[model samples]
Target chain A: MPVYSEKVMEHFQNPRNVGEIENADGIGELGNPTCGDIMKIYIKVKDDKIDDIKFKTFGCGAAIATSSMVTELVKGKTLKEAERVSNEVVAEALDGLPPVKMHCSNLAADALHLAVEDYKARKAGKGPIGRVETPEHDENEHDLLEHA
Target chain B: MKIINFDHFAATKMRPEVREAMEPFFMQEYGNPQSIHTLADEPREALNKARLQAAELLNAAANEVIFTGSGSESNNLAIKGTAFARMDKGKHIIVSKIEHFSVLNAVKALAKLGFEVSEIPVDKYGSVDPMDVKNALRKDTILVSITHASNEIGTIQDIKEISKIVHENSGAYMHTDANTSCGFISTDVKELGIDMLSAAPHRFYGPKGTGLFYLKKGIRIMPLIDGGIQEFGRRAGTENVPAVAGAGVACELAKKELKDRTAHLLPIQKDIVSGVLGSLDEVYLNGHPEKRLPNNLNFVVKYIEGESMLMWLNNNGIMVASGSACTSKILKSSHVLSAIGVDPALAQGSLLISLGEDNSLEDAAYFVKELPGVVNKLREMSPLYEEVKKKNKV
Candidate 1:
């Protein structure tokens, strides 16, 4: 079921821009530990263009590859154009991801969208829109974590 | 590609001797063991011989051994068969938390039928306490199934002690899933005092489609498959003759070579354990230090997911298995790791390296040499690692 494309493997083996930008204009952190993946996207904005971008991800091959692919996709593009990029586009860029992985780890574009949102919120003098509010850990969720 | 298989638990190459034994049954002696024709005579004799060979490996009588389609099938027969046969007496069952899906899911299905199931938790090293089994036993308990050893973490259970407790405390039939321990360890049914034992021939270099179930004499079990007079009217199906013949040869060879194989693997296991753990930081072994299978090694490497590590190692010509959500069909980390209280996040980074007779010191050393580079490469991209690094600076 997990026959990853050659492009996914290549990007996973040698990810590009894999580091956290210490002082970024906007940041988007998607996913949580319980889901077995976490992505933190950092961006540098210059005149509404995503001038420099980097990412740090804790996930599987698809997550890392998608993260790398999204960064490659939106670099040097204006915020509006970057927002047009979607998970399907990122998945298409890497040839394709496994269907199961596409839902779980192909979240790089959402993270980029969140980063652009965070950029907009900051431009209006609001603090960094905090990380996505993951569900409160419940017994059923714990069981899923333990036995799913 | 010269692939070095560190994933023996997932699949094993068939031994040449076992393959040779199966050759005649495939084409030359291809006849139904139940047929009354002359062509059936050889197949019928071969089937009986295979049963005897399998029984001898477990020190049980040939008549008590029932061959099934696979280890999971054997487990289903043992668990559900016993449960259904004794449901009039009791509908309660007990199983360890770390049992294979075959045992766990079978009991789960029973739960929907108004049966009660108690899951005994394991220790941090994945050992189920005998007292927990004793406590879980009820007046209405019909069966108790526990694993002899975990295929994931490699921890061997105290089956003898647990079996003794189950016998003295309750009238429930005792079953042990010995799929991971059958060929690698001594599984004397009388010595362990177990009523039934389930094992997979594929795990020990036989063909994949055959399973071995040992039912103690005088125990009543309802058949999972209701059909003809095959398996003495117990498990009804056309016998997989070629695989059964191969399984017999594999069992015979396992009994003959157990000691030598253990001796050969011990030093290599020790070398790999020390080599990997000593060279890496924030890496930990997953099973009992001394009470683990000689051929199994499992570890959780921090800050990197397991699939990435597996892919990198495969690229370097080594094949291994992982318990990470990414590798699992259900997209959750292994329940065995969770049973031992491993963090779900850390459980996503499990690496399971299982050795076999074909593995050598060079292969173990090669794995040790190549692992750190892969871990480093993955860690460099992990945000979790960045968090740890930032915390350490303070």
Candidate 2:
């Protein structure tokens, strides 16, 4: 067993922000079946700021807790501010993750950045930021959909 | 953090009897076993006696056993040494897909050397069919290396049946990596028809850094290391005398307590399996339900990643393995899980609780009681679980 911090365990045991947002302004999904971690972030952007944020993560406890914490950190923040939310902050929010599972928090940060980026790109008339290409999909088609 | 540290795995510290048996080798008899002096003679005699003790446990002659640094080294020596020694006879080898990386990687290295390697598949329960081995054999095949028990899933293979098939076709040498099964399980080389076998003592309550490879006499194999004669010149290195003595004591202890140890573990294993299965929905047992090691309980919880589950359990003061300890450093799914056709999502959630002789019924009960809540909590936070749940609901 790897050493997980107390806060990480706390959030893992009683995680917040577990469900997806309905009719979300932007949806950001990252990871794939192959990597064994998949996170989907749902955001509701209002007045160019994140009015609401929620997440559903398919991963370890650290990952789910990180996703739950990432949502709490980004809600009510501007798209730019949310984009600046770092993996370190997510890990810090949970106290700290085991070294091997640091990637789980990183995925949480990545999901947030992706959702905020989608909001920014949509505001710029570049349409929504494209869906992230997983190992299985074609980037071109996904990018076209993002710009659609 | 809790003020008092409770390690579930290390709950039973080293027994006084085993520790006492190992004390003299370290304190007073530290002479090299190979030296010609009187002090060396005693250590050498002790080393030979350790060999005989280990051999007696495996039901093999003392001369057949060669001590090595680890199970991985012994496995490497067996596969590579035999391939090179018998190259003139054949350049093909067969192994099961669920074998440890030691065996799989050794065979891969052999392939790089231009040998034809075939990996026979296993059933969903991770048991290899002897008929698969028989069908995979070619006239040019020189060896068939299978595991006595899978490390990940704990399925005990039918070595006796597999060896009979190997012997019937082209007289291929049969080898088994018994690193996980040798001590707790009763192993008889003749009964199993194994020409070469490997064992690691650490898994059996012995000190680490001691392993044994049993090579039947007249079954020629080249040496992986070259140095002054050691281990009958089969492996060349100064013997780890203290560790070997500890291993011999551990083997003797295992021999005396095998029946009781297994009897005690059986219910714990069954309870763990039943508890996990009953508490959780969509949980799958990863190995042969009945033919598994008495101490092993492996399960795949669909929504949580294995590493995270391990971390959560660790935080709760439980010590368990997510996959083979050797492959835990990497984040990739277990090859054994993949080969057995476990879904990628569930494979990420695999957990193994390998009970040592010291693990009590209370420990198993505690894990069973605590684990479902952990899984539920992780799932509650998981978007994938939410999505999967939604999909199922619809």
Candidate 3:
């Protein structure tokens, strides 16, 4: 198994606010399945505050735990407060993620920030963007091994 | 919580009888096998006995078996050693794409040394066609190496057929990385008609750090290491006495009990394949259903990645392995899966459960019982699963 912190394992095993809120105010999805990680965030806003928040993730342990942690960190806070959350902050909140996994999997806060942006866009009568772009995986950057 | 090991391909617990055979070498009969002192008698005899035992397992002459540090070392010796020895005659090599890194990288290094290489591809079930090997052979193809079985996907290759093609068509020698199948399946060099084969004792419930390399008699190869004459001067190192002794016993036991072990494992392999695939949607087996090792089972569960599933199963007292990028040290998914045409997205979800003699039918049932919960939990949190469910609903 990957070397995950206790906090990461805890959040991965029993993630908070899993699943989606039907007819959510704003939904933000980040990453893609092809890159081996995809995270979607759903938010309910009331008077500039995040009334309810949940997430669904398709990824490794770090990705799921980071998504769960970002939800717990930003729920009930205003959009301004939630915008402060970043990949680094989510990783810090969960003790830390593996360095190799941090860049790819620790992006829940980016999804949350997109949700906040999506909500603001609707408030201005623009549009609800479905997904934020993530970088394409450069296959040449890694050395491949058969096992861990 | 009871710890159940399903990762037998990686390592196995040392059997009691093998340990008993090794005890005298650790402290009692500790002497250099190469020494001329009176104390060397027992250690030299022990080394000879180990060689005989290992040779018996492969149906090769005792003088043909050379003890090495590990299976990887043995493969390196077989590939690079053969290449360097025959570079005067030819500079071309042929290998299957699904071979272990040792064989693949050794050939790659040979490519750097001006040797040409052709990687034969596998079919959807990860079986290498003998005709591909026949076509890949050229006048300068001095070596052809393939895996006897894949540890990740569990597909066995037709080595004998391929070996025949190599010998009949060219002067190339045939080699196989039989590390995974040596104990679990039939790996007789004569039956396989291969000139060289590599095996490890650790995968067969013996000690680690000991490996056996069978070089057919009269075949010459350059030595990877240079030192005082040992292993017929082909491999140069002081023999690991205890490990060799344990490995010998392990090989002896494997030969004696191969039939019964296969019988016990075949039913469990079938049950797990049926049980997991039957209950789970979007899950598929990775290897040939009937042409695989008796103890090997691999699957790809869609939507969720394998490392998360491994964590959940490990938390629930079941230990398994995966070929996901997250689980790999280099963060790249299995090349074997890629070679077999599995989608990169689905290959991230690969899970391998390799059984051993110690694992009972109940353990297989327990894995079948526990795996669904783990897959369900991960799928529930998966955004892709939501999309899949939506697609199904619509």
Candidate 4:
């Protein structure tokens, strides 16, 4: 793979908002068992805005970078605005992930969405957020598996 | 920052002595060994000398060594080559779960060609059981290729015992990719009682694109690459004369300095292993405690991924390898860790550190001191870790 962009390397080397919110409005945890990367996202909502956000990622450098970039992208934005965040945007924020590491951006996006979903579900009086699994994987997953 | 090279399993620097030995062949003695000119004399002699040095190291005759492009190619040549040559006899081949990609893919390719493969499993330490090897064999099983040591986890298999079981059960040819253990451990073909073995020169401070496939005399193999008579016509191409000569010197040096090299490396290995395990929480070593390579250390840290750790280490100028999916070819989990029955999530946490002659005690100490903080920092941010912490409290 080509060298990661300076932005990606920077976020990977020094991730931002790398912690959890105590008494959080909602929590989201996502895992890609095959790739052995998992993420847990914490959110604090106020006045319909995601007042604060933080994340912890247990995966590759790209995953951590994406998680960090996602938190920065989503924080202070309204929940609806945050929902507009996408994998491409997260990757773009990093300048670009190596094509192989693009899925890590998906994982980051999924975790953020799941956290938002959990917040909505709690307001609707759902008991607790359970672990979510995305069984479908892209073809790129196979390349990283075989090569890495 | 000083870079501590702990990815020797992936590749190594060519020794200066080996480079100097190969220098003449690249210029003055640049004739192809296949040519009948006087220029061929020097390369031919160098090839001959390399063959002998490799043979001496493996305790085999000069005729047994056939140079090849890479260790992976040598494995392809050994497994597929043998199976094709003996297809009329049997079509069954057996390889353990932790065999390198070269061996696994070669076997899989054979499977596509109508050959049956029995994959033997490994224990938690990544050690393949000899009894399992025995059980997996059948009358039609013609080849059993198990790695002598796992490059990922550093677990060394008991090839002598496995070879005994393989031979006793069937008329199977035993081949081990002993590249990881070539210099650090004993890989004598006679002592191991194996019929074939593959090794890469680059693994032991030799040139890349140079390796050897040890085919026991009278064990026929259909060549993978065909052309003019080279590698005794088993592989057809002009020999890489410089790499061959370089590899020969590297082998000679490895044979003489194996003990001292081991002595120099084992302490750093021990310090790093013990230090990391001692300072960390919920972390476990991946390979066998006693039977692992002296310079190898593999581990799984719970509730985290190896890539993050690798990044941290790289920032500190320490190079290592990870078993995380994102670091792999297809974003799939490590088969070696899974074969040992580890949870896939935990497998993402795998880290391997291998020592080279260049590493020192202080380097080991620096890694040991820095590793705990990285793990703890990642864990602290992990909500799963918070859940676990909460659950543990309850």
Q: Which candidate is the best by lDDT?
A: 1
Candidate 1, which segments miss by more than 4 Å at Cα? A133-148
Residue lDDT tens for model 1, A1-148: 4479999999988899889887899999888776668888999999989999999988888999999999999999999999999999999999988766767788899999998888888989995986784332232333333332
How well does each candidate superpose onto the true structure, as a TM-score? 0.96, 0.89, 0.95, 0.95
**TM-score of predicted chain B, candidate 3:** 0.99
lDDT digits (tens) for residues B1-394 of candidate 4: 6888988878888899999989998779888887888978988999999999999888999989999999999899999899889999999999998889899999999999999999998988898889998988888999999999998888989999999988887899999999788977778999999999999889889999888889999988899899988888888988999999999998898899989988998888888888988998899988898888888888888887788788888888889988877677467768888888888878878888877888899998999888888888778766557779999999
Model 3 CAPRI rating: medium
The digit string of per-residue lDDT tens for model 2 on B128-190 reads 989999999999989999999988788999999999989988668999999888777888898
Model 4: CAPRI class: medium
Which predicted model would earn the best DockQ?
A: 4
Q: Please state the CAPRI-style docking class of candidate 2.
A: acceptable
Candidate 4 residue A49 C-alpha distance from true site, Å: 2.3
lDDT tens readout by residue for model 3, B1-394: 9998899998899999999999998898999999999888898998999999999999999999999999999999999999999999999999988999999889888899899999999999999999999999899999999999998888999999999999999999999999999988888999999999999999999999999999999898999999979999999888899999899999999999899989998888888888998889889998897798998888999888998899899998988999987787566788999999998889889998999888887887888899899998888888888898999999
Which of candidates 1 and 4 is the stronger one according to TM-score? Answer: 1
Error of 4 at B234 (Å): 0.9
Residue pairs in candidate 2 whose N, alpha carbon or C atoms collide under 3 angstroms: A56-B383, A57-B382, A57-B383, A130-A146
**DockQ values per model:** 0.47, 0.34, 0.61, 0.64
Lowest summed lDDT window (length 10), candidate 4 chain B: B324-333
Arranged by lDDT, best first:
1, 3, 4, 2
lDDT of 4 at B304: 76
Instruction: Please report, as a residue range, the 10-residue window in candidate 2 chain B with the lowest summed lDDT.
Output: B2-11
